[model samples]
Target: MSYIIMEIKKISSVETYPVRHEVLRKGKPIETCIFKGDDDEQTIHLGLFLDDQLVGIISVFKEQNNLFSETNQFQIRGMAVLEEFQGKGLGTKLVKEAEKHCINLNANVIWFNARENAVPFYEKLDYKIIGDSFLIPEVGIHFVMYKKIH
Candidate 1:
C-alpha cells in the first residue's frame, strides 16, 4: 500500500507566489498575485504540501471590512489549489486549518471576496454572502462572503 504524505503549515509570503501565480494569477501579471498586506507581520500564509510538493496555498490577513461590524476580523486572500489536485478536498483542509488559526487569534469573523463560481464552495463551508456581486477588473465578478468565527 502507498501513502500520500500531506502536510499543512505556515509559510512566508514570498513562498506563496509560485502557486498563487499559477493558480490565481494565470494570464494576469505575476504582481497581481501579491496581495496588499502579504508582508505584514501578522499576516498568515498556509501552504499544503503533498510528499514535499507544494500543491495549495491560502493567506489570511489581520484586516477588517467596514461591511462587517466586528472590530477584529481576518480577511482571506489568494486561496487556490493547483488545477490537477482540484476536487480532492485539499482546499477544504486548508480552509479548516485557517479557521482554527483565526479562532485562536480571537477573531470575530473571517471574510473574503469569493469569485462567482467559488461562492458555492464557501457556502458549503458555512460562509454567507454579504452584498451584491461586483467586478474586479482583471478578475471576474465576486461577492463578499463571511463566516462568524466567534
Candidate 2:
C-alpha cells in the first residue's frame, strides 16, 4: 500500500455545493434530504486530500443542542469516502482528525447520527450509542452516538 497522506482543511465557498452534492449523491440514496442546506452555518467541513485528489470528507458542527440533544459536543456530518478509497483507513483518519479539531475547539464530545451499517465502524472507534434508531427523511435508519474527546 502506498503511503496515504491525509490533509484536513476547512471547506471553502467554492467547494461547498460540490462537496454537499457529492456526499448526498454518492454517499447513499437517502443522504439528499439530510444534507439539504445552503452551507450557512458555523459548521467546520474538512476534506481528506491525498496529495491533490479529494478522497474523503467529514464535517463537524459545533453546537449546544440539536435533535440528538447533545450539548458541548461536535456533530459529525457528511462523512463519505470516495468508492475507490474505501478500506484504506481514510475514513478512520478523517474521523480522528475531526475529533482532534473538536477537542481543539474545547468540545467535550463528538457525536453523529450514524447509519446502522456504520454502527460497528463507529463502535470500533469507541463511540457509544446514546439512543434508539430513527430515520431522517431522505436518510436511512441511524442512531445518535457519542465519544468523549480527552
Candidate 3:
C-alpha cells in the first residue's frame, strides 16, 4: 500500500476544483454558501494518490496577520479521503504533509476552521482549539484550531 502526495499544480491546474467541490458537497450544512473555485487562492491544492490513482485531497491557504504573528501561516480549507480509504490514516497523513509543506515555506503555524465533528481527529494530532465557535453555513459549525510548527 504505497502512496504519493503532490501539489495540485504539479498534477493539473484544473484538477483541484472538482475534488474540493465533492468534499464540500458531501459534508456541507444547510444555509452555507457553497464553495467555488474562485474561493481558492492560487496554488494551494494537494492530492494524494495511491498506486497512481488519485484518492484523497486537501487545500491549504496561507495568511499573514500582524495580530496573529509576523510570518505567513496556513489554514486548511478543503479535505477529503475517498470513502474506501477513510480509516487508513490517510487524512492524518495528508495533514502532516500540508504541515511539512508550510514548514518548508517558513510558516510558523498551521491552522484551520475545523468542523465540530472533526475536532477529536485534529486533537489527536495535537491541534488546540483557539476561539469561539462559528458557523460557516455550507461548511458547518467550526472552531479555530492551531498547531505551532516553528
Q: Quick one: best TM-score, which candidate?
A: 1
> What are the TM-scores, per candidate, against the unseen true structure?
0.98, 0.79, 0.77
Q: What TM-score would you give candidate 2 relative to the actual structure?
A: 0.79
Candidate 2 colliding pairs = 30-138
lDDT of each: 0.93, 0.74, 0.70
What tens digits encode model 3's per-residue C-alpha lDDT throughout 56-142?
787777664333664777777677777787788888988988887788888887887788988999999999998689997655799
lDDT of 1: 0.93
- Per-residue C-alpha lDDT of model 1 across residues 15-61, encoded as one tens digit per residue: 89999999888987877878899999999999999999999999999
For residues 1-150, write the lDDT of model 2, one tens digit per residue: 888566878775345445546654655543352453326576777878888677777877765445444457778877888777788788899899998888778887788788888899899899999868999776579888888765
Model 3, residue 44: distance off in Å is: 2.8
The candidate with the higher TM-score, 1 or 3, is: 1
Off by over 4 Å in 2: 1-5, 13-20, 26-41, 66-71
Local distance difference test, candidate 3:
0.70
> Clashes in each model (backbone N, CA, C under 3 Å)?
0, 1, 2
